[model samples]
Target: MEFVERRSGISLWRQIADQIRIAISNGEFDESGALPGELALARRFEVNRHTVRSAIASLAREGVLRVEQGRGTFIARHTKLQYPIGRRTRFSAGLAGQIKSRGGFLKSHVTEAATGHVSRALELEPGAPVLRLERVSSADGVPVSRGISWFDAERFPDFANRYESRKSITAVLNSYDIEDYVRISTRISAHHADPATLDDLKLSPGAITLRTEAVNAEVAGRRLEYSHTFFAADRIELDIDHQAGTALP
Candidate 1:
C-alpha cells in the first residue's frame, strides 16, 4: 500500500481500488495470496479502514481478491461456478435472484442495438429493430461474465426506450402485455472471447466463455424474445440438470 495524493480529486476509495488492481496485476500481491489487513492498508494509505474495505470490495467484485468473513482477504483462486438455469425466469430477475442466493452481485442495464451477429441471432432482417441489453454478474466483486442480449425489433418496438429508464426487462415485456412465455430452446457452446467481448468482459486474450443462445415464445409459440449470453468460463460452470416430468418453470 502507498499514500495517494490528498488533492488528487479522485475519491480515496477509488484511488485505493486502482492501486490495488495494479498491484494484483503486477504480481505485487501473489496470485491466490492473502492481501494485507484492512488496518494495515488504511495506515499505509492514510485513509479510514472503511475506505480500504470499500476498495477491497471493488477489487473482489472484479475477481481480484477473495474475502472470507473469518479468514480474511486472499488473492482469489481460479474458481467459478455457473449457477444452473434449471427453470424459466426473466433475465433480470433470474440473475439478480441467483446472485443473491449464492452471494454474488448483478448489474444490468440496456444499451443501443448494434448491427451484426446479434441481429441475425434475434432473427431480424438486416437493420430491423432489436433490444440491446447488458448484464455484469460478479461473485465477491469479481466480474464472472458480461452479457449482451438482443430481441426482435418489430415485436419489441419500444424495447430500447423502455429499458433506458428502467432496470427490469421483464417488466417492460409485461407492459407490452407479454405476461408469460417459455424458453423454446437453448443452445450452449464455448469459444474464446472476440475483441469486443473480451473488452467488455475485462479479460485477457484467449479467455474462454460459454455462449448460450435461446429463443423464447408464448404458449402459442409466437416468438417473444431472442438472446445470446456469454459467461466467463473461469468464473462460472454451467450446470445442466435433467429430471423426468419436470417442465421448465
Candidate 2:
C-alpha cells in the first residue's frame, strides 16, 4: 500500500502527486508512456477517484503529464538532460551534443553593492561594487535553468555590455584577456522552487529545483565569477565527474 498519511497535515493530492512523480522516475510508466486511467490510479492508491484526479491535474500543471480529454493522460516527453560538473564546466559545452539548440540570455542586469553572500563569494569588501546578471538558459527552446552571477565591477567595468554583445560567457572572458578559468568549487542541493525561480523557469508552485552555487577563478587563482544556478528538477540531472577534466557524452 502506498503510505499517504491521512491526518499528517499534508494534502492528499499533493502526496499522491509526489508518489506518481517517483513512480515516473523509476520508469513504472515506460510501457505505455501514459498513466493508467484515474479509476485505476484511485484503486491502486486506495483513494477516491476525485483525489486521484486532483493529483493528475497538479502533475499536469507541473509539466509531468499531458491530460488528453478523449484519449488518456500521457507523460511529457522530457528526457532529463545530463549536465556535467567538472573543473572546466561550461553550460553550452556540457549540453551541446544532447540538444539541438542551447542558449542562455540575459533577462536583466544591474550594478550594485555586494551583499554579505556576494561579497564573500567574490572576495570583495561588504560595500564593494559588483555587477550582477540574471539569466535564463534554454535547451531546444524550453527554459531549463535560471542563474544569477556576480563579477567584480571594478575589474570588469564593461562585463555586462560585452556579455550582451556576445552570448557566450567564455567569449566575453576571452576578450578581457582571461585565457582560461576553472571551476574552483560547486555546491549542489535540491529544494522547493522559490517564487522568483519558479517564475523564471515556468514551473508550478510545488515543483522542485536543483540548485548549484559555483565559483570560478583564473589559472593563477584570481576569482572571476560567483554564480548560483537553479535547474528545473524534472528536466536536468547534475552529473559530478570524479575525474576533473572528464568530458560528457
Candidate 3:
C-alpha cells in the first residue's frame, strides 16, 4: 500500500500522478503495459476514485500514459535520457547519443552588480558587474533543464547578444577569444520543482528536480562562469564522472 502526505504542501492527486509515473518508468506494469483500473489504483493509494482519475488524466497530458476509451491507461514510449557531468561537461555533447535532436535558447538576460555569492563564485569584487542569463534546454523537443548563469560583464559585455547569434555557449566563448575553460567545482542536490521550473520543464506539480551548482574557469584558473541548473528528474539522470579530477578550491 502507498500513502500520500496530506501535509506535504502538494496536492494529493499530483502526488499520485508523480508516483504512477515513477512506477511506469520502473516497469512495474510491464506485464500489462497498462494501469490497473481507477478503483484499484484508488484502493492502492488509499485515495478516492476521482483522485485516481485526475492523476491518470495528468499523466496522459504529459504523454507518459495513453488512455484507450475501452481498454486502459497504457505506458507511453517515454524513457529517461542519460546526461553526463564531468570536468568538461557540454550540454549538446552530453545528450548526443541519447536524443536525436537537442537545443537550448536564452529565455532572459540582465546586467547587474555581483552579489555576495555571485562575487565569490566568480572571484570578483563585491560590486563587479555580471551578466545574468536564463536558459532552457530541450531534448527531442521536450524541455529537460532550465539554468541560470552569470558571467563577468566586464569581459563579456555583449554576452547575451553574442549568444543570440551563436546559440551555443562554447561558440559564444570562442567569440571572446577564450578557447578553453573547464568545470572548477560542482555541487548537486534534489528537491521538489518550484512553480517556475515546473512550467518551464512541463512537469506536473510535485515533480522532482536534480539541481546542480557549478563554477567554470579558464585554463589559467580565472573564473569564467557560475551557474545553477535544474533538471527534470524523471526525464533525465545525471551521471557524474570522477575522472574529471579534484576541483580547485
Candidate 4:
C-alpha cells in the first residue's frame, strides 16, 4: 500500500483518487474487478473512511468507477479509441474504421514570431516569423483532442487561408509541392486538464489529458511543422505503429 503524501499541497482525496486510477490502469485489482472496501482503503492510505469515500465518489463521477447499492465499486468498461502515432501520423486517417466520422475545423490562426522550443523544433532562428494554427479534432462526433501547430511564415505565407479552404493540412502542404512528410520525433506525457482544455473537452476539474509534442518534416529532412497536442485521457489511447503505410496514401 502506498501511503498518501502528507502536506503535498494537494488535497488528500485527490491524491487518493489519482493513486486509485493508476492502480486500476495497472490491473492491480483485475482479479476481483473491484476496489478494496472503503475501510480497507482508509486503513491502507492512513485516512478516514470519509476521505476514502470522497476519492471513490470522484472516480465514480469521472466514469472510472461504478458503484452499486449493495455491490462493491468496480472499474467501468470503457472502449477508448486507439490513436496511432508513427513516422507519418494524420488525424482522420489514424481513426478510420474505428469511428463513424472524424474531422475538425481550424479554430484560429495567426503569424507570430517563433521563440524558445518552437524555434528549435522547426530549425528556425529565434524571433523568426511563424504561422500558428489552433485546431480541435473529433471522433464519432465527440471532441477528442486540441492541437497547436507552427510553420515558417515566410515559407508558407498562405497556410492559414489554404487550410481553411481545403480543410485538410495535407492538402494545404501538397499545394506547396510538399508531396510527402514524416514525423521526426514525438514526446508524450500526462497532466491534468487546464481550464480552457477542461471547457473544450467538456470535462470536470480533475480530468486528465494526454499531451504530445511532435515535429514533422519533408522527406528531404527539412522540418516543416512543430505541434503541441492534448487528448482527453479517458476517451483516447495513443499507440505507436512502426509498420509501413501508417498514414493513408
The parts of candidate 1 lying over 4 Å away from their true place are 1-79, 91-128, 132-141, 244-249
What tens-digit string does per-residue lDDT give for candidate 1 at 63-162? 6678999989998765445456533544434455445432222344343554766555455566765666666655555566666667776577777667
Output the TM-score of candidate 3: 0.90
lDDT of each: 0.66, 0.88, 0.87, 0.87
The C-alpha RMSD of each candidate to the native structure, in angstroms, is 10.9, 3.2, 2.2, 3.5
lDDT of 4 by residue, 42-100 (tens): 99999999999988897787678899879989898789999999887888788888989
lDDT of 3: 0.87
> Model 2, 130: alpha-carbon shift in Å?
1.3
Kindly list the per-residue Cα lDDT of model 3 for residues 1-249, writing each as its tens digit.
368888988888988987886787677875668788999888888889999888888777767789999997888766688888888899999888888898878899999999999999999999899999999999989999999999999999899999999888888999989999899898889988899898899976667899999998988999999999999887898988878763534
Query: What are the runs in model 3 whose C-alpha is more than 4 Å off?
Result: 246-249
- State every prediction's TM-score relative to the real structure: 0.54, 0.87, 0.90, 0.85
**TM-score-best of 1 and 2:** 2
Ranking by TM-score: 3, 2, 4, 1
What is the Cα-based lDDT of residue 168 in candidate 3?
87
- Candidate maximizing TM-score: 3
Please estimate how well model 2 matches the true structure, expressed as its whole-model Cα lDDT: 0.88
Error of 1 at 234 (Å): 1.2
